[model samples]
Target: MSPRNKNTMLVKLRNDSQWSSWTWQQKLRLHGKHGLTRFFPNIRRKVNEQYIKYIKSYKIEITPYLLSLIDYDSQGNPQKNDPIWKQVSHIDLLSNVKSADYNGVNLNWEMPEEIHYSILHHKYPDRAIIRLTDNCLGYCSYCYLAQRTLDKKRKTLSSSFQIKWNGTLEYLRKNRQIRDILLSGGDPLLFSNRRLDQLFKDIKDIESISTIRINTRALTFNPFRFDPELIRIFKKYGLTALEVHFAHPKEITQEVDDALSLMDDIGYRPIILWRSPLLKGINDSCGILEELLVKLYERRIVPYYLFHYAPYSPARSNLSTSVKKGVRLLSELRRKIPGIAFPRYTLFHSSGKHDIPLVQEGTNEFKYEILANKQYIVKFKNWKDNWVIYPDLQDN
Candidate 1:
């Protein structure tokens, strides 16, 4: 056999063995900087002083499967320009400001007043979000919930919030206006099969709740997590739709395809939908996004939303792209791909989620203005019909 084929077989066997034997806890134990070096020798030399400092400031928890996707050089070191590496790793040059909002208390864009227990009653009456856990298998560099996921102390729901599962269910039961429940957090798929089974059963019991949407990134992070039991649970609950986060085309690996095939084989084929933030230098380009959306469409996944990167904290400001840039990219994409493959370019603001209008010939809602301090800003009407001014990230 060829050396390349032999190496491929060996890797497959190793992954299969690990999946069968290692518990999620065992896998998690191998996370962080040490795990990167130990599992992949290519990353050892790359773990320098800057990498150490970045991890110190922001938590690093990447799954082994996800780390394997990053491209490495002939010297056995991770490529600095690898898209997968850029998504997970922190770059010092991108963010220089140290913000005090690391705790994530003020980062709640859902608004504190609307929160009842662990439930976030969205400004829209139809849907509400339930934060299952403030933990994920891996941490994305541009995650809006960086404060909650990065800080180990706040992994669980805080006592001050008085959040409880029972209370959340009760709130949903009482509010007949809520027809949809979004199971979100660091990622709801991180829950065990037993926990997910019970959670699904409880949510199913809600007569008023017509749909339950789970937002997760597990499909890319660790496709092995979607074992037979999880598929069984999904089938039993009749869950047809799953919102997955896939930032780049590189994230769609053979393992991810196998997981989807497994689901299909079991007759529990989920209607997969994609949602991702338009991060600067990550997936901000027309070609990159076009490829990602087209790939997702080919796999029968709907391209749902391409979000404007939220600068929740000063530390994450570098990842933010100009809203105009995002719109322009989307506009360009509209001409290149099918309408079904096109994703809505959206902005999650303090007011609510708003779709940013593209640059068209007709009268547009977007207005550019210069402030007294010579700061550039964009004015757009929010969900509440109130005009809101957003800082333009052109200078950044």
Candidate 2:
């Protein structure tokens, strides 16, 4: 849908009494292809049988709140380049899967050796991530942890949290070197208030854990999830920061502003930070990113990291952009926005996270190599100072 029409629809939906009263769970009932077509009827014709089968295979979850943000054409079909739709919908999954295989892209990026139970301890010895739950209010098609989030044999929230708790706590206690703990999964915020409180209390008891950060898209997926109780839990345990994902400026709706206001009321605004992958047709333009970063800064949310899209599954290759393109965009952004509004351009490799150097007049920091098969790859120095080669997406 056109931006103007989208804004109009959003305004109308926000004022609807029914939409305003619905709980997060009710809003979440919009799941899979049936729910999608119910709202946007034209999608039924745009997507074929194969696409429907693929979506069901991986599963798709979209909240009414998020659905309201997507733009649709006059015919009620989602706009081809709609950022929110691109992130949540599985329309391009089959095609991207074919392209990824044709290009010989890696389907999985998780480092098996670095994983223990639900925790992933990579190059950073001082930090570790605990997968607290395997459910999310909504699912992003490009997520690197698709194996867990999209798994058919997914564990219940309670069981998943319980199973990981004991082992994760034991590991954290043994590793005094690890001071930072990131609570991630499908998203840690999906935990109920009581469960979240318990989680905070448990993690707080660890003497070695100095910082507790929650990686969540609650602000975007379902801002209503940030109620008074949730805010209290964050304050009670002293959450260092909330690493939020905001891929486009359009995502910063009034609801999101209201959620931020709640945090501001409690003086927790300083801890809100943003991070998102550079997706090809979504927020890849220099103007879009600048607007997104500026909007975030205006709301006191620090722009943390603009990541190079991880090619974790063949179905996500369409979203991936060349590291070169990402760095260039950041370099341009660096020139336009204030230093505080800028974020590091990073790439997550099996070894660790590495910041991609920006292109400059006389710098030769970026090292490129051509493989025997004529595929281009870039060499990066990992956190351990070991050189790692990564496939560079061929810019379209």
Top model by TM-score, which number?
2
Candidate 1 clash pair list: none
Candidate 1, residues 280-382: lDDT per residue as tens digits?
Answer: 7888889999899999999999999998776454345566777777777788788899999998888777677778888632135778677887766678887
Q: How close to the true structure is residue 311 of candidate 1, measured as C-alpha lDDT?
A: 49
Q: In model 2, what is the error at residue 196, expressed in angstroms?
A: 0.6
RMSD (Cα, Å) of model 1: 3.8
RMSD (CA, Å), each prediction = 3.8, 3.2
**Model 2: per-residue Cα lDDT at residue 249:** 94
Q: Where does candidate 2 stray beyond 4 Å?
A: 1-28, 46-48, 98-109, 120-123, 151-160, 360-365
lDDT for predicted candidate 1 compared with the true structure: 0.72
Model 2 per-residue lDDT tens digits across residues 1-396: 344354443455657776643263445445655666666555555474555676655657777678777776766566767889888876456464433332223434556677776555443688888877777878887777776676444445555657667777888888899999888887887767898898789888999889989999888888888887788778878889899999999899998888888887876643878999888899989999989999999988899988887655535567787777787778777889999999988887777777888863213445876778777678867677787777776654
